[model samples]
Target: MGSAALFFFLEPDNALLSDVNGDLVNAFTAVRDHPIAVHNRLKKLPTGSDSYYKTRAVDPDELPPLDAAARFIYLNRFCFNGLYRTNTAGKFNVPYSPSKTGRIPSREKLIEVSQKLQGKRILQADYAKILGSHVRRSDFIYLDPPYAVENRRIFKQYGPHVFGSSDMEELASCLEKIDAKEASFLLSYAYSREALDLFGGWTTHRVYAQRNIAGFVKHRRRACELLVTNIC
Candidate 1:
């Protein structure tokens, strides 16, 4: 999110938007304020490749007009690790992923992001309901819901509350409605034929994404992902 903000600053003129499913809103809000310095420091502090900066770097002044810049949505469940699991009380219960470098919440970035998103509305609701009212033409929607197969463990293994098979079906239905409304939309998911069948009409493009998991290789490992889009 911070990287997107910084990139907007460098090469302005684009409306920034992020769909963070509930859990990470505070972190998202924090980084949107002043992502430059902190993101830079994070890059320098963490030993990584040069491309890191290139990916996150953005212009400061050229950032889109705050009022008209980018926007963010705090949707669905707002808890942690995007667990998509809930407790008996219907609260998200994803535990935080601890980092050795400690929490990196950038206050200024959140403020800046908040300011840029002045007129934007941030609501917490189901994907179907949210898109039902907000989707419109000229809007670009990015959907990164948990993979149906990978996320299925939450039913009994992970916890009581989860997206489950029905939730995935509903998500697909929602995206179809958006497509019907003439809104351009993009979806990211594991590259599986069954997953592709979910969005039957959309063209799927294969893309590589680096998965960053804690206690792992510490280097981003490449994995094949599918980008389902109705644009083409």
Candidate 2:
């Protein structure tokens, strides 16, 4: 989210938006183009368990493109802590939050966001594939891969098992190519020895982020993380 804001501020002409989850990418494209549709759909659906459960059952692929995007937006906005998780059957199973009322992005905001996606490339591919082919000399690449920390793994896992030490190693190898191409890059990761070892080069900086997503109120506090870059 922060990266998107920064990129638009810098006004890059082209970009590749890649994610392993095709559903999310597709829904985002839909919402980007038809934010009003998302807003309208969400408004029509009543808040509470019945509506949330019923909406969750609707298979995104089976629905019209706009409806599918609305489904994705609705769940994220009203689900517990806005965490996207799935069951063994790969269905969204996050419980409806007692909190979180109201609609998602305003119609005008969506229009602006849709305009941004007008010429940008959206793909459902691994990071290596898109970044390998598209990134070139002087291109800026930002990696905010899910952290592999043990205790925090359960909450932070974007997928059932999307990231781990091995995945981090693969990403590190990709950095080599980016370096060879003389491209500038920045990656954010948790403060851990493994993170340091995998991304320890060029320059490193420390920063803190509030742990606002913890399930328990007591656990909500600031945690340390690192910013790694290929520049001084």
Candidate 2 colliding pairs, count? 0
Q: Write the per-residue lDDT of candidate 2 for residues 1-232, one digit (tens) a residue.
A: 3125455676678876777776788776786677677668766777778988999988888988777777887787787776667775677887888474334666777677787777787777888887778888988888777777666654343666567667878888888888899998888788888878878875899999776555556656787889988888
TM-score of each: 0.57, 0.88
State the C-alpha lDDT per candidate: 0.50, 0.74
Q: After superposition, how far is residue 153 of candidate 2 from its true place, in Å?
A: 2.0
TM-score of 2: 0.88
**Per-residue alpha-carbon lDDT of candidate 1 for residues 1-232, written as tens digits (9 for 90 to 100):** 2124333454334443444334333334434454454344443333232332322233222333231121111111111322234456544343333333223335465456556654444444555666887788777776666555653332332334534566767878877888888888888777776677786667889999876431235323676788888888
Residue 24 accuracy (lDDT) in model 2: 82
- Which window of ten consecutive residues has the lowest lDDT sum in model 1? 68-77
**lDDT score of residue 197 within candidate 1:** 72
